[model samples]
Target chain A: MQYPEPIARLIDSYMKLPGIGEKSATRLAFYTLGMSDADVDNFAKSLRAVKRDLHYCSVCGNITEDDPCPICKDKTRDQSRVLVVERSRDIMAMERMKEYHGLYHVLHGTISPSEGTGPQDINLESLLKRLEAHKEIQEVIVATNASLDGETTAQYLAHLIKPAGIKVTRLAHGLSAGADIDYTDEVTLFRAVQGRTEM
Target chain B: MQYPEPIARLIDSYMKLPGIGEKSATRLAFYTLGMSDADVDNFAKSLRAVKRDLHYCSVCGNITEDDPCPICKDKTRDQSRVLVVERSRDIMAMERMKEYHGLYHVLHGTISPSEGTGPQDINLESLLKRLEAHKEIQEVIVATNASLDGETTAQYLAHLIKPAGIKVTRLAHGLSAGADIDYTDEVTLFRAVQGRTEM
Candidate 1:
């Protein structure tokens, strides 16, 4: 016997999310059913609100309710440096550290040969145009993840930005702060050794 | 920097789901933003639909769109037997097997001393009333899980139903088919030895 129509639709909707399978979808569906009515209302309202209210910031390619985003709108932030990341969530991680005060450019995705995601597919064109418009930006810091596609995208961005006399730098990748050398993976260990700092 | 209000609300909503944390919720919120408008609309619709459309089957306590549920309404099913399970999901599992043709009773939960869940907390009163009404149900098969609470519930059910001249049975406990003896846990191995039957 099939799950009733409403629950089956819910399970199917949940299964569309990354990493959720049939069993997990079923569990979530039941849990949703058990949730209080007001909470469910808020959940559905938020679901619609994400699409209805949010938009891509025209200047930075970051997700925002405002057109240019709060980051771009703020004239007080440092204008000389911009950190580039593959996704907007990386900006949250950076901001959480409370260190970086420079602007950011969200690529939205990385170029991958296997996936056929070309450089043209991502939000690179807007970044290029933004740089062309703003000569005060002296540095472009690539904070894309250390994955193969991320590295490729960073390299491509560096090559393109270097012609404009802007310094292009990649985030230093090494063994994480608390990670032990013995337990560190080979690639991380190799990067740690390669990027050793002067004492 | 804070995420935009809409996306932040969406992340908060995603975090309300079981097993989804802040990071995962952020990922899901972004993924949802990337979804097509139609899929997102459907997702929100399904969320609302599960709450609005489906309800408990008053007869069997299974989740259903209809009042009695398909199984309870069916006149062809065996009237002499009733399978009692801990949750509505269990009925889905049983129906998938297609081996049993009896009606079902959903207990919703098991009796657990540590958690302080008693027999009265589950759907037991209706079950007793149903039994009192339906003299044709000669046997009650307790198909709760094999945990301590499940066993306690089964014994309690047996104790209560036996006085009414109804036979109470339990799902067999032993090693599952294709389970290797060397890999089996001690309790299962012991149960396998004790419940050995003639070939």
Candidate 2:
């Protein structure tokens, strides 16, 4: 028998999410049945609010309720050093680290030649404009992922921003904080040895 | 950095679901952001509707939008047989087979002494009342999961119903269909041997 119309609709909705299938959707729908009315209402409200209230920051392309986003608006942050990333969530990650008090620029996506995603396609033009407008900025830290597309985007950014006399830097790649040397890959090990300090 | 207010709230809501943690919730929240406006609206509506529109079937304790549920309301299904299961989702699992054309009685939960879930704590009274009220039901097929509590509940039901001259039966325990014989557990193999049918 069909799961009553309401539940069936909910299951279908849940299945649209990544990694969720028909079985998991059905399970989640039933679990929702057991939740308190207030909780269910709050959940629905949050789901709608995420889509309704949030928008990309006009300045840095980061997600925020404000047009410029909180990070973009804050005058206390180090405006001279702007960290560049592929997504707004990357900004959240950096903030969680709490080490970098600099401004941010979100690229939204990387330059993947295989996928036909070029500098023109991603959030590139705005970066150049932002740099041009803000003469105080001295450094552009390319904190894109260590993937091939990430490297390509970083190189492209360096090539363009270097001519403008602004220092362009990429995040160092090597062993992650908690990684074990025995299990480390050859390339990462090589990079770690090459970049090792005297200490 | 906080995931802006709306996305952060959405992530928390998603974490309330079974098997979803902080990382998965974050992924789902961002994915939701990427979903179309129409799809997001439908998802929110369905989430709210599931809580607002659905209720437990008054007759069988199965969840449904209707009071008696479609299974209990149907006249074409075999009135002589009633399949007993632990929860509403179990009924859906049974129906997916498309093999059973009988009415259903949901127990909501099995009798588990260890967990302090007694027969009285379950939907047993209504089931007994239904059996007495409807003399047409000639047989009961106990289809609870193959677990200790399920076995106890099945035995309890048989004891209570058999005295009324109705034929009470439990679903057979054997190697499941498409099961590899070599990898099958000893208990299941024993049941398979004991309950072997004549060709």
Candidate 2 DockQ, CA atoms: 0.85
Write candidate 2's Cα lDDT for B73-185 as tens digits. 99999999999999999998899999999999999899999999998899999989999999999999999988999999999999999999999998988989899999999
Instruction: Give stretches of model 1 more than 4 Å off.
Output: none
Q: Of the candidates shown, which would achieve the greatest TM-score relative to the real structure?
A: 1
The local lDDT score (0 to 100) that residue A18 gets in candidate 1 is 95
Model 1 per-residue lDDT tens digits across residues B78-141 = 9889999999999999999999999999999999998999988999999999999999999999
Per-chain TM-score, chain A, candidate 1: 0.98
lDDT of prediction 2:
0.92
**Fnat scores for every prediction:** 0.86, 0.87
Residue pairs with backbone atoms closer than 3 Å in model 1 (clashes): none
Give the winner by DockQ: 1
Encode model 2's per-residue lDDT on A1-199: one tens digit a residue: 6788999999999999999999999999999988998888888899889889999888999989988888888999998999999988888899999999999999989999989999888999999999999999999999998889999999999999999999998888789999999999998999899888786
